[model samples]
Target chain A: MSFFSKIFHPSSYAPSAPSLPYSYDQQGQTYSTTSYPGNYSHQQQQQSYYGQGTSGGGGGYSYGHSGFPPGTSPDVIRSFEMVDRDRSGFIDENELQQALSSGYQRFHIKTVRLLMFLFKNPHDSRRLGPKEFAALWSCLGQWRGIYERYDRDRSGKIDLLELRDALYGIGLATPSSVLQVLISKYDDGSGRKIELNFDSFVECGVILKGLTEKFKEKDKGYTGTASFDYDEFMSMVIPFLVSYD
Target chain B: MSFFSKIFHPSSYAPSAPSLPYSYDQQGQTYSTTSYPGNYSHQQQQQSYYGQGTSGGGGGYSYGHSGFPPGTSPDVIRSFEMVDRDRSGFIDENELQQALSSGYQRFHIKTVRLLMFLFKNPHDSRRLGPKEFAALWSCLGQWRGIYERYDRDRSGKIDLLELRDALYGIGLATPSSVLQVLISKYDDGSGRKIELNFDSFVECGVILKGLTEKFKEKDKGYTGTASFDYDEFMSMVIPFLVSYD
Candidate 1:
């Protein structure tokens, strides 16, 4: 089975069974299973977490104990290095922007800034070195894990239905029509399939996660509910829509 | 003294003396001090923390003892209600986005996402009620505190020199040239003065904090030092430069 397919197989979803074995080299650019040291057991632990949603207390998903659950992959690290144009051991904002825009597709500058903010060290708020880059790489992996978990048919893509599940799984309550709008925005009108690949999956995740979190913030009192007028809703969702431009 | 001046006076930097008081209403649209209990004391605690960097172990700045340090403001709450477009007693994603973008200057979708993610409750990830919105508002207050603390002249603006201090205060080791480039980006080439206002200050803080944290992640050995190749350094610094566009 393909790596993505293998991870989504019904057998892998069994609460008791460990999921697939996945690991990356220190650079996080390459993937390997041999000589990976305790990764299988780690994957097992992670799979159990994913299978049961035991880490559901946070209202969002938690991939591993902390710090790069699947560990960093060589592919992720190499992506960062490619962006490090000057061969500096660190990745700064411009380099990061270039890397992200070119590699992951163009993200809003604010989104890129936020991602950098989210990924960078709290103490060293200037640049990202190898370890920091690894953390970022690992984050993508976590998102991948989320994507794979929801790609139940092992299709390596997420349809509208799967997208709904993915959002709900991560704690979003998007309306059907709103979701349709979102899907249509990304749909290239290629095939009848209204599905998202890994990149689109990540993008969708980013937008949904952001919107949901923002909504929850307003819903203080722990009531799980808040109100918004039309303008407020537009302000929140329009930026994420493709047509916002 | 002016609000900005009062907060940034050199004496305000004293470790023991409490700093000035600042608070936002529910919408965070208006700034007010009425009906805000204990916020002054809370500001005192927060200022002391900022002045001495007592919470310095993590290599990043820490705002409160827990979540919502200065607590929420009435204006922040009002802001949420204003955004409840449908009057359905709930502000959905679109409403939330509209409120945020129009109210807070157009933030990157990703940044908005991160804010939502950070502010939303763990258990209820769908909508944000008043309390959650308060938490989000308070976070902006915290960012404002950071901004005010660094606005040494109480100018309500962060000059390039002040920006340097802001970065350093947050535990970044920025080179002078890198700092210069960053200043030039926001200079506007008007007067010889190069500075950032509140919004820009907040943006700079987010980027700096993210990068610093990322750097610290790599300095795992805690030798208090990490190295970067030329390309790596470029990647790290270029993002903060003024002329990147």
Candidate 2:
């Protein structure tokens, strides 16, 4: 098979598949888990937010938002209200991150911003209102289903092959060159190969979704190609890259 | 802004932020585009396959499979036949790989196997029959919608941040460590920070999805954690790690 095909498919390629997961800390030493102190952390803040409600109990939180979309599920509406700690009927990236971390999964602020960007709330671009929150929540629900279905063996992490299949199942025939770059970005081990826990998988999907969506906008002709001036590209993408404290 | 947050969040970390994209080929030399020989490769075989069809006119393939699932799109069914090089009633990883490469984006063999595994064919596990092919095709359609939506900048690639957001939008709050490792895996640059072109993005998502699903099998409680005897873990993960010849 490799002969007939490999012989035929000569082309432009970048296949830098990482063999073992390389562990590197910023200071050039091994990253220690103890460095994260409990005194002050997004974790503590997130925990505090959850503590105010039924901590670890799937639902039943301090929700009072009556402005939710008419057909929004009580679970989703309450999820939004739970995150609106100030009772202001709005949730920013941090709040969204906290809420998800507590109720569903832990998300990075970067991911939350992408959510806000995609499920933009007409009420506020910086945050989500009841309507926008419901929309975003439902979207998450769909993805969750997809995630559950693909986790075939129930190992809590998908291996390299499974990941490839999942992408194809979704119509994105990802090239190997790109796959190497994509997985390498999420190195989480000292010397182990990278694998996707649910959280990591979600991150991977979101990144792809965002890139594909952004590309489609410019590639209006479905031409599989597009062009962007540098600054224009940065403004469009930077919001997803920076970590706002 | 970094004070209350950064102070409280002093902790364990692996912050090997690549200052620039370092381009390294497998041979410890720069991976040059010219290294790929055109005399024999999968590209030529794929080209020959396309030449047999209405090249670039999508949905025009030499399909003879009549066993497709009910309600299958004609486009998808036609696509299956296009890749069945020998006109067999089924397709395997290489065939799927070739079909996807020609019709949509080029996918790695590793990924095609994942699709077959996820959407296993009742007729054969090694290959996909009409039923499995149809199911896999439908899933791709759903992902296509998502990809277009997140490609916000209309640029061909998603910066690190966009990838982060897209994952969160889907309900997976990816951690920093994982994100870092993931992107580093796909380093396609000589000295450029990693970015997600559509193929790369899909590759990222597939890897994560596969990993997450595998992990879930052992994490029946949705515990976000799982344990495996060393041998079990290796068997489960090796398919993803190895590139089948």
Candidate 3:
């Protein structure tokens, strides 16, 4: 029989095909798909309320905002150029290195490692170009809490204070005593309250190695490649947080 | 004024603070906030006609029928030892490679690149264990199309006629005149049809450089480390496809 006929008429093809490709060798125990943490209902609710483009009457949903400019090849190139300000023909390791090192104090070793794992698989010599870089940036932008907190002065620099707010916003608490010590030690000493700049702020936070370690350990082995796979991440984190604290 | 007070009453803070961040680079680019792809009208029609989720109200629409089981632990390590009949502890790369090399014809290079891009990105690497692997397997089940075309008897094997039919499916016109030439060249003197089992069929497809190039070009260079930044990729591809085609 013809292929079209087989597809349309299952009887023509004989017994029903398997719904999914996976099968066990002999354990007879079906692989469980429901293992992610957090209530499925809650996760679905959160995604529906906040996910920017889950589904829509169109391929995209604007939610009553201005639509995306008609994307064109030139526009894509232009956007890439804006991100790769140096126009180095390719976004080499140096550029990514710079971005990573820019404010090292805020970055944990584990976080950086996690980021690297996504880049090129442990020094395979493939540096992320404009496309890979853009994807990561777009993901960071969608991290609502992080983005919201980082936009200090609503200007969005997240230079220092904003970063502080972000860490706290995500449930990482900084001890007040530690903050006091940092301010007093690093302040310009003009006898006025000190505004913590990047360096000083990172010092305060990074010094809490125990805290960083705890958070990192908590995030072990979650190397999913899709940002939208929040269910995966959230599931790991929530149960661990409840258990950890 | 206190920082909180200044924030609450923006007039109380230094006027320069709020304006400064926005104006640092460009003032008017107040984020697109909403943008997406494809024709809205078609999507709306599909939504109503097919009962497909198409709007902010439906969270699962982006994935179509590809839905993960509800309530999976993002960090839970569902032991695979029970699943692997040999107790390999892990499903090694060799298994995947062998599977591809054996039954499958040369996979589209673009599909490989896309898969690599998905697997390589760090943000998305959140422990792609068995369940996650199943999801990916389901999505790529489209490969069954190739198998179906070649396996003529529905007995999961291919004879000469089936192979020829498979080749012809790709627009490799097999004229009646060429059929005689091929039969004479390939068939046994006994008049039996020459057959290519899965392995030989795979080898033939892989050797086709033209098909490889087509797919590789299709799957290269996307940013979003966690997901294919459909928006960014489409922005460049759409314009090029429209103008060039």
Candidate 4:
């Protein structure tokens, strides 16, 4: 299974990484984990996040966690070193962007923008570092928050009843009319449950990715930069699509 | 009350709107009142989301789920009309640059490059518009979210306890230890909670205005056009700063 597959199927790969087996010394600074998050079975996701490129210094996301063995693998260490710029053991927006930008001449500038927005703080100048980066990737890699609403019963699939209740929990009670429309669109032949499998995931990703690319081009046009910037990348893109259909 | 203040106290002002009653149905779109959740007390908070500014023809976020009289002083609208060359209800980054250049000439080139990073998207050709501009403002205006981890109860205030929690939330538990080092040396004992009040709002607006100026300058620096081309903006600026603590 690729890492993308693993992220959506935590149950299938939970055994690969139990609790991220790393520890901290009072500070929130964490060490390296003994295992992978199983969901990241594929390496492309790492490439996307770390900013590594096959040819030279384009950029990509780093994969190494803090305090982990240095010789995990060239690809892994390369990922770590890129994000661990300044070797401070933390990968902030700066480091992450540096890591994620490798091997590509053009990226969706909006992605970088979103990243900068997510990590920015008016009161502090500190950027996200290694530990924070790791935690974020761990969460995103598995699409944890994207669930929107979850079926806690672990029934292996989420149905309308389960999804509706989850939305209600978040203070959003969809009118029955809207629900019917969504069901007719998403549900296939049978009306039992609506499961968002890999196809749906890929479809959603493609659509969002398209929107993201649009923002990147505009960002490039305004800034006059040929390459995509990490900070303003997504901020300029997400707003148009933040609403549900 | 100033525009920023009205966001917090909507009822204090008289409703003089003359257009169709305050329904979300403008521009052939049906918007839900629920979409404008929270009261005017929080509108100012939305304005500051992701560091929105008022330098050019960008959108402004107004709270209060009611109506504003028709001829209720087109000051805000003036800000938009100041640019919007075609008055098509949308202002691209280039239009924004033109609006700001007329005011602040020394906004510089690097600043525009940085600003572009803040708005780029990789998926589509869309740039910032009024509705998006308002939404972005709202998302970042709630300054509490920026520092809320430090303020536990969400009472919209930050105390010492809250500050300590913030330190812990970021992985540093020893508040006394780190605070003694960073804060004691740099704290200055101002007793300020870094509130997002009116004064700060103005300062933020000025900063965004500065961004507009910078964007115009960058465009001029490139082909002397009103807007910067994608390549010119990026190549001219190196190692752009994402944040300065």
What's the TM-score, to 2 decimals, of chain B in model 3?
0.29
Worst 10 residues of 3 chain A by lDDT: A16-25
Instruction: Identify the runs in model 2 with alpha carbons over 4 angstroms from their true place.
Output: A1-71, A102-106, A117-126, A229-232, B1-245
Report interface Cα RMSD per prediction. 19.3, 19.4, 27.2, 19.5
lDDT of 3 by residue, B81-177 (tens): 2223354433333333333333334333323322322222222321234434333332222223454545857765556566556544433222333
Q: What is candidate 1's lDDT per residue for B26-134, written digit by digit as tens?
A: 1122212111111111221122222232121232232342233343333443455576678765555556656545333453443444344434554444455555655
lDDT (C-alpha, whole model) for all candidates: 0.44, 0.45, 0.29, 0.32
Per-model TM against the reference: 0.34, 0.36, 0.22, 0.29
On the 0 to 100 scale, the lDDT of residue B222 in model 1 is: 37
lDDT of 4 at B58: 28
What value does the lDDT take at residue A138 in candidate 1? Answer: 42
Model 1 fnat value? 0.00
Model 4, span A32-116: residue lDDT tens: 2111112211211211222212211322343354543322223334455555668875555445544444343222233433433
lDDT of 2 by residue, A1-245 (tens): 21111211212111111010011112223211110112111121111111111112343343445765344445666566566888877877667666566343355554565466555654455677776666555445434445555667877567666676665454444555556545644544244666675545655565444444443444445444444332223333333332211
Task: State which docking tier applies to candidate 4.
Answer: incorrect
The candidate with the higher DockQ, 1 or 4, is 4
Model 1: TM-score for chain B: 0.47
Q: Compared with the true structure, what per-residue lDDT tens digits does model 1 show for residues A205-242?
A: 65555444444444434243444332233233323322
